[model samples]
Target: MAHKKPGGAQWWIVAAFIGPAMLAILIVNVYPILYNFYMSLTNRNGPRRFPEGMYEVVGFDNYIRLLTQSEFYAVFGKTVLYAVICVFFFFVVGLSLALVLNHPAIKGKYFWRTLLILPWAVPTWITAMIWRFLFHGQFGPINQILRSLGLPAPNWLSDSFWAFVAITIVNIWMTFPFFMLILLGGLQAIPTDIYEAAEMDGASFWQGLFAITLPLLRPVALPAIILSLITTFQMFNTVWLMTRGGPRTLPGQPGATELLLIWAYNQGFAGQGQRFALVSAFAIVVFFFLLGLTLLYNRVTNVTKGAYE
Candidate 1:
């Protein structure tokens, strides 16, 4: 295919249409990122004893500290763990649900769909707060229920491992509706004739699913899955709300629930003068990690090349 050059008039029209969008993208999305990048090289945090420290131009000093610190490494590891778990389960659970919800004979489908989507409709911060109360160590509904049933009720927010598990479950619950809706749309778009043909071939449901349905749905859902993964990778508010990063003693780390976002939050806001630049450095690292993941996903899935005919 030959690239056609846009003539002068067309270029003007293109700019006319694109001008507002580009402006919005820059102001709303791109500027903050660049600002953070610039801030990453400064020392923006300290005690009142060092007011001069705020404006100090410490080139890559923050980045050096973030890279060399064991606490930072632990946080990064936790972030990766959280992202991996949430993305994996979110994909599986969301796709499975979307498949089931799209079934032809499912009764009260609209009602069920609406109910399923309700969780997503609620503000995530509010949901997180609610779940936090439900998972409270003393009077939480979870423990109460478990106790009533004569079962062990693990501390959902206290223990480090369980806190991660709880975070994953919350994330999965919060995000499944999006996947359901996307997959539902994809499933509806699939050609019925293909399934009919599989039936004619006496193909089992599983065979048809693997051979036809998955390949067909990939194109529609792949972008959504990628997007969800990206968002979940940078997840912050839910876990923060749930535990306030939790009881400090359990993990024996510098902070509780040592995910990158939370760690950055602690660094930026915790004790004295906010370490905005250090936080920015950590944020920059996370941004690259997510960007790398997106690039890898695109390469593996050929998402940009148009996967479906």
Candidate 2:
């Protein structure tokens, strides 16, 4: 018999109610992650074709193949390039926006914040499509505006490098709002006394920012930056919808804009050779690579806790 305290009966009742939720986590979340781990060792397609069509364990062949393939390497490199570039731009733009908004003199804060974040609220696909039209060589508003201003408008979509830039522009627009909000939170949490104290010491505005405020803000903002990097590293949909990885990238290589996710999609759906095994291998490799990267970054940065302090 379960012993119940005088007023603790309700606690037990609540526990009984939550018992099923714990079970759901075990069944839904934990199980899928474990199942994926198991699947990573094999070369298998969708649900088994028959009872006997079990997964064939290919040892480390999937990983080996994924790491060794030139196409995979190229895609991997592009993924890193895209992630780094986008994060750099996002950090710079978002931090600048946060700094500006943190100023007491800035008016219409709520309105400006809502306007900035509207892009994030809009559906990604819609934003991507809109950007596609805006980058369209013949009739994009961008081109029209340039023409109206008496400036030459380059064909944005046709050029490989420019198309990649177009993809980054959309991603940056979608992401910067999130960064700004997080950084703004950090900025707001800062103690006003620190600035006042610095001013009393004859510190200049820039000195207060560099010597006092930045150090304090970094601790609060580091996690946001790390999360952004992880998400950017896995970015896909916008680039996929915008470029389709391109007109004719190479015989087998991914286009300039094709990151690892698109490369995996192409491989998984590659008509001539439907290599589900290979695709799984690539995904597994990417997963571990990102995992390793996060761990290493965390270790090196020593940003585990209270970095701002």
Candidate 3:
């Protein structure tokens, strides 16, 4: 007969199995957040290598500076606009392709799927670099083609409007595949019988889509959209690599394409004087903003409930 172990012994055994992972998480994730919060409350500046006493607590000064500065609002606005545009296009392109691929007449579905997903499969940094070359006004194939067609070849990276457009296009290209995959899976999981019934009722394609497909797709789509929004909001690699948040349109202001994370990164490392505490404060504010966006999404949509229902 197997003897039951003591409760304390079982607890210890469980802890032993999980202890190292927990410690690793604390060191990697928890420690950084705690340290960042600590830094936000101080006046830490200069390089990363510094003695503890070099900085002292400044309480809410950093946060006050971040909030009161008009530059913060401008950057925040641009970031929001970028995320909105990218996510909107992501859904539209993804849903359109998914619908087409789901059609009964479409052939070589796998090939099409692979082709569409290629952009997402490529490393993001590589995508950014490739697009940067593609947008070059003088030597880029895009401008060459435009010249051949007698069309204007605008300065893509140097003009603020065109720079924004270039980044938006790159972002859309890199991300739409993710939405397509998710939405395609969601569409496939839906029952054919539902559509057949709608057809029997003499519904047109658009009617069926609005009345049936879209409603059913919401449970999956909303969550994906919100997740995409959050990801796009924090996106740095593509924007930074391509534009470095440049094509500055205004004096004493943030760059046109300088999104939130890029701004935070620039504050810390991209300048002669590193403002570690200010950057930390900015990060904390961004963290809270994202947290609020998530909570608000859940509260408004009740996505978890809809998924089960």
Best by lDDT: 3
What TM-score does candidate 3 get on C-alpha atoms? 0.91
| lDDT of each residue in 1-309, candidate 3, tens digit only | 345664456777989989999999999989988999999999887775345778888798999998999888988998899889999999999999999999989999999999999999999999999999999999998999999999999989999899999999999999899999998988998999999998999999999989998988887788888888999999899889998888877765788788988888887878754889988888889889999989967865764564634
**Model 1 misses residue 60 by how many Å?**
2.3
Which is the winner by TM-score between candidate 2 and candidate 3? 3
Give a tens-digit lDDT track for model 2, residues 1-309. Answer: 344665545777978988899899999977866665565577765444112356677677777766777877777777788888988898889989998998999999999999999999989899889999998888999999999999988888777788888888999999999889988988888888888888999999889878977777776566667777788888878888888776444576577777788777866664544566667666666777788878866864574464444
In order, what is each prediction's RMSD in angstroms? 3.3, 5.0, 4.1
Give the alpha carbon lDDT tens digit for every residue of 24-102 in model 1.
Answer: 9999999999988888877775654235534766699988988998887777777677777777787778778887887
Candidate 2 C-alpha error for residue 126, in Å? 1.5
List where candidate 1 sits over 4 angstroms from the true fold: 1-16, 48-54, 250-256, 296-309
Superposition TM-score, candidate 1 onto the true structure? 0.84
What TM-score, over all chains together, does every model reach? Answer: 0.84, 0.82, 0.91
lDDT for every model? 0.78, 0.78, 0.88
Clashes of 2: 1
lDDT of 3: 0.88
Error of 2 at 92 (Å): 1.4
* Poorly placed runs, candidate 2 (over 4 Å): 1-55, 270-273, 293-309
Q: Give the lDDT ranking, best first.
A: 3, 1, 2
Clashing residue pairs for model 2: 219-308
Q: Comparing candidate 1 with candidate 3, which one achieves the higher lDDT?
A: 3
